[model samples]
Target: MSRDLFRQAAKERQTLFNAWLMLNNPLALELAGEAGWDCVTLDQQHGAGGNETLLACLTAAKAAGLPAIVRVANNDPGLVGRALDAGAQGIMCPLINNVEEAEAFVRAVKYPPRGLRSWGPYRAKIGYSGDYFTEANDFTIACPQVETKGALDQLDEILSLEGVDMVCFGPNDLSVALTGRLDIWAKEVQEAMTEVLKKAREKSVMTLIFCNDADFAKPRIEEGWDIVAVGTDAGWLSSAAEATRAAVSPGS
Candidate 1:
């Protein structure tokens, strides 16, 4: 199987830098890869992206030799399986409220015995894994989001699931879960985040942190976050647009 960049990074205990692409733009995926992000996610949940768009993004990521991670809308096994068949190297399912949900995410991403991930990787893993059926199961990474009070309480059990390879902390959703806000640094939100990180660390599982600013990423890295995605494709383009507009505005 082709070496999954994200998995190798996690296995090596290397910090991974991910860039979110909510635009569903293949070019943007390619651009992010070219710009040196370790991996990229096709943010389907809020990305106005569906299966077709995600497939294109996956192809772009593959062309760039970067792993394409798709953030699905919910903990649906069917969606997860389809994404894997569509060539996504990894999957990030959101709103996983408990260990059962976490396990379901695993069932969706992994093969039988591990979990019933119906036999259909299509041809996505053919060239990548050499033997689509056997090798594909071993290499695909399953990441579930821990973003609720229920998830927080069951963090340990969730981490104990063998099929779950990584847990991504959704700061926005976590903050909402804790205090009904999306502020990442809010006191309550920060506490919840620390708890998740602590639990993941204790279980020896990798964790992903989302940062809005480049500067804010350092502290999370120091705190031992295994994966840190610094904002989204839309955020990057919007920031650049605002800057350009400001430069040509009356203030200049």
Candidate 2:
């Protein structure tokens, strides 16, 4: 296949830097891909787009020689298969609260024997090796978000499931679940995240965290997170616009 750099990075124990796309803009996705990000993920869950937009963005990312991933709206196997068939190299499922959900998410990405994904690699075969079908199971990454109090409680079980390659933390939702607030740095949230990180490492499962910036992610990286999404395209664009406005209208 196309080398599966994300998986390779995980295997080599490297911290992969990823970009999040929420604006449904192909040009923005292409720019982010070319800007040296290890991977770019389309946010289908909370982002303003759907399958059509995701496909276009995936194409843009591939043109820039970047691996594209999709965070499906939910843990539905059908949604997972569609993303894979549309050429996504990885899938991130939201609110995975138990081992069953985790297993189902993994099964949807992999083919039978290893999973229950129906055979359909329409766009997935173009740039990949001739043996795409036979090798796709290994190349595809399946990550489930541990974002709620219930998911946190079952973190160990979820990570232990076969075919679950990585576990990503959604701090915003987790913070609310833990403290009824949005402070990701709250003591309770941090403690829970620390436990999750420790358990993931113990099981050899790759870990991912969403950070607002590099500074926010540095400590987590040092804490052994395998991947960190720096920020969303929408957030960056908005921030730049605000900075420009501030510079021009200092007193306003």
Candidate 3:
């Protein structure tokens, strides 16, 4: 299998950057991949696409030589297996509340004693690398999102689990779980984030976080996050449109 560039960067403590794809357009993903994002994640959890679109997006990423990660809508093993078989380089499962959930998420992405993923690398083999089954277990990445109060409570245990390559912080969901509001900067949320980052470092697990843009992510990188996902393709489109409108308008 091809080396997991993101994982390599994380090991070296380098700040790997990723682009978010919430839209179902393959062309947009292809463009984003070509634009040089270290990785591009397809947000199936909250995004508009399904299995078919995910396969297309993965194909597009491969064509641009970019690694593709899929944020699965749930922790279902079949769904996770399908994404891997379809050529996704990584799987990000959301709302993992404890070590058991984290273990299940890891099992779904890995093969054999390491995991329960059924054997089948259809497009993954042809598109990604050779000796698919042999090297896939080591090449694929499994990231469980730390987005709930329960997860934050057991952050260390979750990060210390075997086969878990990294953990992502979903500030929006975390804020809601803590204060019943979507304030990413809430004191409780920030504290939980700090704790997770510190524990991940102690355990030698990689850290990832979703930020609104580079500006929002800059400080977090300094705080020790290995990978940071910037703005979504949808957000970028809207921002560009708004900027163009402002530039052409003469008077308010």
Candidate 4:
């Protein structure tokens, strides 16, 4: 965890923490890394700003010795390609529903021969590696998310996509897809998530869970989910702010 930036070295298991820097705060991202997280995913989907912010966040991750991953806005090959070129060690594509979509997602993250991502290893990734393009592809991780009812149904096939290194479960979106609820611990949503983990184990792929608490992460970890991201940077800040408000306001 301390040594490797990307958690790619682990074949059977690993734990990655999400930076979820929705506010594009580099200090928050640095704090997450310093707190001993394996890696941080820059939440591009449902996040503010654009590539400029992403570049700064990636720089912070590198400086902290934590690999930075980008959860891309969509499954757009061009966007995915640019994110990688910007020096993101990992790329997470959201709402992947089936093998075809998974295939396309993989294609966007990987370079030619393995994919059609076009050549741009000369970017941040290489710069950090001391101009080492010889083994750049091996270090890049491509994560395609399984977040909808449709995607859950095709979990096995989605996991089968070649260049995809991990499957991150978007619990909030998945809950809406399952029972139309966004609450963190919705029952139907939990059941659906368990099933997704079970199938992910069967396919021999790494699993990343999105949860707000360590308690919520237990079942997923027991189910062999490789990495669990507790919450977003925004949520952490909001929770802290609320706790401070309660402590100072009319307490018993």
Write candidate 3's Cα lDDT for 9-75 as tens digits.
8778888888888995889987876777888889998899788899888888888778888999999
Candidate 1 regions with alpha-carbon error over 4 angstroms: none
lDDT of 4 by residue, 1-252 (tens): 123434453463654555566777788888887887777888889887698888888778778877777989999988887888887877888988778888888887777777887777545554453433545456677888878877888877777777767788888888788777787588877777777677766776667778877788776656656777877788888999999898889852
| Overall lDDT per candidate, in order of appearance | 0.83, 0.86, 0.86, 0.75
lDDT of 2 by residue, 120-222 (tens): 8899888786598888888888999999888888887888888887888999899988899999899988898899888988898888899978778999888
Query: Is candidate 1 or 2 superior in lDDT?
Result: 2
Residue pairs with backbone atoms closer than 3 Å in model 3 (clashes): none
Model 1, C-alpha of 22: deviation from truth (Å): 0.5
**Pairs that clash in candidate 2:** none
> Over the stretch 1-252, how does candidate 1's per-residue lDDT look in tens digits?
677666677677788889888898988888888898988878889987788887788888778887778898888888888888988878899888888888878988888778788886774865664776787667788888887888888988989999777888887888778887777889987787888888877887778887888877888988878889998989999999999999999969
TM-score of each: 0.94, 0.95, 0.95, 0.88
Residue pairs of candidate 1 with colliding backbone atoms: 1-129
Give the poorly placed runs of model 3, Cα more than 4 Å off.
127-130
Where does candidate 4 have its weakest 10-residue lDDT segment?
1-10
Mark the regions of model 4 whose C-alpha exceeds 4 Å error after superposition: 1-9, 127-134, 183-187, 250-252
